[model samples]
Target: MATSTLSRWFHGNVGMVTSVIAAIAIIAIFQIINPFFLSPQGRVTLVYAMSYFLIVACGLTFVIMIGSFDFSVVSMLKLGAIICALYIDDLGLMVIPLALLACTAMGFINGLLFAKFKVPSFLATLGMSMVIEGIALYLSRGFLHIISNRAFRSIAVTFIAGLPSIFYWALAIWGVCIFIALATPFGRQIYAIGGNPTAASLCGINVVKKRIYVFMLSGFLSGLAGILYMAQFGGGSIEMGADMSIPLFASVIAGGTSLAGGTGGPQRTILGVILITWTQAGMSMNAIGHDIQLVVFALIAIGMSILTANRKTMSIVK
Candidate 1:
């Protein structure tokens, strides 16, 4: 019976462990290919790349927990950056709060439509995302906004105790989100809604409220990620976060989070983002082109999705 129990535990959690191992392997490979990948400067740079990815993944994890997919996260990220850059000269830190608030409002709108109007989450998010992107372009007039503030700029580029500030932000965000997921009443409600909305509602969970909160969390995180992007780059563009959509989603799934919702945590997603960032940075430093790197990541995401699907089928059969 002990052996049987051990086997069952392994079967259930092997994927999570394997993904961590795979991430470590990728880091090792990067270290081997570019000795700089292990050097202090290189390590900090890698973490810098991982920061925004981690932030976006955190928000996506919550949204996915409610069994809803959000494609507008990238657009929200871009919008936040645009807003921060456009207003920072006049507003300084105030821009940060305003950008986060805007993203939250956008999420609230999406959630309201999804829950009240019965619009499919995917379609609603997609349409909202386009609208956001459009607004970003209009504000920028198809140009980049150059950010000149030294203090805010340091938020991404400065090193704190041998780590990038963005890295610290990523860690803080993950830590806080994990705490909420594990300890908060809202977090419990989100999981319940994700696991089974109908049953959760029957059990007195306010499914609509939970969904709104989840999306709001997603929006806020995306906004913060955009701000980080601007700080890191010293400027922003409507295109700043356009390429992050697939990679952010891929990181969540690769980290063993269920897209069907109610499973996984920010910690797992962080591991996944770190792995992908390491892989991308290592290749780039070694002179590998962006096209090849993206293709490889796409393939990895596909494999993980297949694995997740097969595992679900096996569970049902059992």
Candidate 2:
């Protein structure tokens, strides 16, 4: 009986246990390689670097948890930043709301294409990403749009107790997501749909509606990340978010969220974001090449997949 109980406990908590262990091992290795890797300044820099990505990761977590992929997140980020920059001069603070609405609409369209038209999520998001990228490029004429608003800039740069203001923004967003994912009925429904859509639908869950909501939330958060990115960089560029999907996906998966879905949440994503961000920061500190960093990220994704694979549960691995 004791052995059986132990087995059940380990099975229930294996994801969290493994993720925490991996994070600690990586940190220890980095710290050994570079003594300054854990310095106060290094930690602060790591947090700042991860702030925007965390926001994006939080949203992506939901989409992934639904057993769907969203490749348009980078495009949404770029589009949101572009939209905000284009109108900030005329609309002032109103640009923030306008940009978010535009992003949400883009997400809604993705949902419509996937849920209503029966287009595959992967293809729908990929096509939408291309279209959005084209729109951003056309609007900017393939040039950077620099933002000069002090108020907007301060949102990213301002420090509170020695931490970037954007960190707080990310934390708040992450906190809300955790609440929604764990405490709300909507959250439970998401897991149910992801676990078995047929079963969920038969049980009276609105699979289509929830899937749409997931994409919309993903878009909204991606837009939020874009706005923050513009604030931090003081500009918007067509290529700003081109390569974000890799790290964002890595963070979600590394944090213990199963690629197969039906398990994991914002809490797991938080740890994953920290691990990936720390890895990136460590590489920078150690003067590792960008190409090598990309390789490391790829490995991290592959490692997480191997670690989390459950042949019994993963019916269709994407």
Candidate 3:
């Protein structure tokens, strides 16, 4: 029995082990190629970049957990950043909550269409994403806004105990997500609804309500990501979050989350994001072009997809 339990724990945590191994291997390769690759400044930049990807991945994790995809995450981030920037001067500290609320509303709308109206989550989110992109373009007119407020600036620029402020926020959010997934009744409901909505409904879970809640939470986190993105950029544009949806989704998949439904958590998604982000950072520092980075990421993602696909088969064979 003890051996069996140990095996279960190992299987469940294989993704984490993979991420650590990847991280260490990448560090070694980079160090060999460029002695300064693992320097203090480089490590700081790594954590800085990881903070944004981590927050975005956290939001994506919630959506993936519910067996739904939101293609509009990048758009949502842009919208949230623009909204927060617009209000930071007038609303001061309130800008943060207001932006998050707007993000939640957008997410709720997406969820309502999917959960209540029976619209497919992907299609609905895609349409909403287009709408958000259009609106964001209109609001900014393709220009970057330089927010000069000290309060807003501090969120992204300030640090404590040598850690980036954004890292703290991401860590806090991650803790909340961990608590939800591991301890909360609502979190279990998300897993149940994702794994089998029909079964969940029969078991007295309000599937629609649960989905809406998850979507709302997803949106709020996306918005929070935007705010953090803005802090890092010292301002933002309509293009702030462009091209993130695919990578974020790929990272979630790479982290060992099954797309067919509920079998993963934020831990997997965050680990995947860290690996991808580090890969990108290391490659970019090495002068690898964006095109090459995309290609490499695609190949890696494909390999991980195959692994994810074979998980059930591997289990059965064992």
Candidate 4:
């Protein structure tokens, strides 16, 4: 009975337990290696790295839990920021909403294609990603568009308690995501679909509609991250939001969310974001090469995917 109880407890709490342990381990290792890791400046930089990361991961957590994928996250981010940078002078604050609307629309299409038309989620989002990137490039003409809007920049850079406003924004959104995942009926349906779509449908859940909403949520969050990125950096360009696929996906998986789906939450992704971002921060402090960092991220992503996957749900290749 004791063995069974322990097994049950571990199975239920594995994600939280592992995430906390991993987060602590990363902090300790980094602090020891870099004496300045806990310095005020380092802390600020770490917060900046993790904050937007958490923002992007919020939507992804829901998507993963709902058994879908959105590869267009970074692209949407770039596009949204580009839209903002191009028109912030003309549209002022209105451009922010405009940019978000554009991203949300893209997400809606992603949902319609996959949920309504049976496009593979991966292929659907990947193609959408290319389309969004092309739009962003055409709009910006591959030029870096810098914004001089103090008010807009202040949205992300305003320091509170030694951290930027973006930190609080990310934290608040994460809390909302947790509530949505654990409290709302919609959130429960997401898990239901992720766990077993056919069973969920038989139980009266509208799987198709919910899947589309999930994609839309992912798009909104990704776009929000892009807006914040623009504000924080005072600019938008092709240079920003490039090659972040590994870090973003790896952060979600590293937080103990199963790649096979139905088993992770934003609550866990926060820790995962901190772990991956801080590790990147630490490695950058140590003068690690970008190529090496990519390798490290890829390995971590692959390893975590193996560890957290629900093998029973995966089909045999043969």
Question: For residue 263, what is the lDDT in candidate 4?
Answer: 83
Highest lDDT: give the candidate number: 4
lDDT of 1 by residue, 1-318 (tens): 999999987665554776788888987777787788889888777887898889989999888777778889999998899999899988988899999999988989888878878788889999999899899899999887898899999988887788878988888999999998888898888878767788999999888788888888899999999999899988877767656777777788788777666777676787778767778888889999988988878877777666544343222210
Ranking by lDDT: 4, 2, 1, 3
The lDDT values for all models are 0.82, 0.88, 0.79, 0.88
TM-score of model 2 (CA atoms): 0.95
lDDT of 1 at 32: 80
Model 4, range 85-116, lDDT digits (tens) per residue? 99999999889999999999999999998999
lDDT of prediction 1: 0.82
Model 3 scores a TM of 0.92
- The 10 consecutive residues of candidate 4 with the worst lDDT sum are 309-318
Output the lDDT of residue 10, model 4.
85
Per-residue lDDT of 130 in model 4 = 90
TM-score of each: 0.94, 0.95, 0.92, 0.96
The positional error of residue 102 in candidate 2, measured at the CA in angstroms, is 0.9
Specify the highest-TM-score model's number. 4
Question: What tens-digit string does per-residue lDDT give for candidate 2 at 177-197?
Answer: 999999999999999987888
Off by over 4 Å in 2: 1-3, 313-318
